[model samples]
Target: MSRRIIACEVFKPYLDKLLEESGVEAVDYLEIRQHDHPELLARSIQSIIDETKDVDEILLFYGLCGNAILPLVSKGIPIKVLRVHDCAAALMGSNAAYRKRFEGNPHKRYHCLSYGERDDEYFARTSPEYRKISEEYGEDNADYVFSMLYDKFSTPVTYIKLGLDGEESQIRRKEEGYYSVIEGDLGLLRRMLKGDDDHVCVTLHPHEKFVGIYDYEEILTTVNRNHDREKTREE
Candidate 1:
């Protein structure tokens, strides 16, 4: 069977053009908009739900709304929310609530597609012609390619360890393997810690291997130890 799908968009006409060009036989489109501020994405989704009541599935390309939007969209529609984005790419996904506004067509099946994944599949389909990128820039260049593709979807990772060598060393440090007067990347670790504590303080020596296994507990302990050590020397 051909892919029967009713697609939703804040702008309906735009969606129509896309369908014709792409040759998607089973797609329905809806237009959503708000004059006040585009940031109020919830309103757009509300429109979809009101306009569309009997959908089998919805395909949305918007924010990854995390856990926030699911409750509202599911309240009115029984169909599954189909979210799509590019492969680890710039276009991640939209909140599900925005999806609720669309009218569901029982004839359509639900699925999500991201250009990012399709792009990968496209290159893979191209084969040796696609392999030219790897031949020219090397495999490591794939990160740059992914980075470009995921630009819409990517965000900065919060808990980053600056200089850890390997996993074995990390597990050892967690197991108290650095038992005695040990040197480690204390200063860098301290910078990484979030909470302010009075109990622990840790010193980092430049020569020591940095361990990344330290969770919130280890992070706090390191901070507290270093805090006291500073005071002891002052006294």
Candidate 2:
């Protein structure tokens, strides 16, 4: 069997390009890529289960906003890999309140929060500016966003994209890690997904490696999808 790596929404193209050069097989590069947020992610995760007839290794990318990742960890997956990334502009202006919330739970799992204002508020929560952002968003801004990020990060994320499915996703899972789902068949997924063998396949990534992240800009120069440039301008 070939060592597969499935790239989610944002990282799919870059991974695809790399494979083109590496002569690597890119499976569900398109399948698992998803929009931001927890609900979408959960749906996407479920879809892979429904589509893939076999279990396989998966590589999943994630921001620090969803809360679902934690639950996925508790559940069973072959080998879950969580991608973590932090943005530079997002780190500015935060208060101690934000730090206390996230920093206290440092031991569980730490990944990049993606690049944006949300992550900025997330990182600077303890910097004294956190409260200000939270005040504008809410007292629980960090907690809420973090939870959402993890939700999308975890599972049940929906496929907001066009032209993707389970088999393609499996190919990627076999290669890269998607969410908490590692590469495994129905038998292995039964323990966690609670579905029939014919129903779903699991794609798991190692949180250690998944959580381990580098600058995305460095890897892919042209990664503009799903994210709303207009929204950024509005913010």
Best model number under lDDT: 2
Each model's lDDT comes to 0.30, 0.34
Worst 10 residues of 2 by lDDT: 86-95
Per-candidate TM vs. native? 0.24, 0.32
Model 2 misplaced stretches (Cα beyond 4 Å): 1-4, 29-34, 63-65, 73-77, 83-235
lDDT of 2 by residue, 1-235 (tens): 3233433434443344445655656455432223345566655554553444344543333323243332333122343333222211112111122243345444322222121122334444464455665777886775666455453343322112212233344334322433222121112212212222221222333231112123322211111232356569888
C-alpha lDDT (0 to 100) for residue 218 of candidate 1: 31
Tens digit per residue, CA lDDT, model 1, 1-235: 1222333342233334445555544444433222123335445554554476454433332222332222223333332222212111111112121123112522211111222123334334244534676678876675456444433332221111222243234334322521122121223112112112222222222222112222332321112224456789999
Candidate 1 deviant stretches above 4 angstroms: 1-39, 65-71, 79-235
Candidate 2 global Cα RMSD:
20.2
lDDT at position 225, candidate 2: 30
Residue 74 shift from truth in candidate 2, angstroms? 9.7
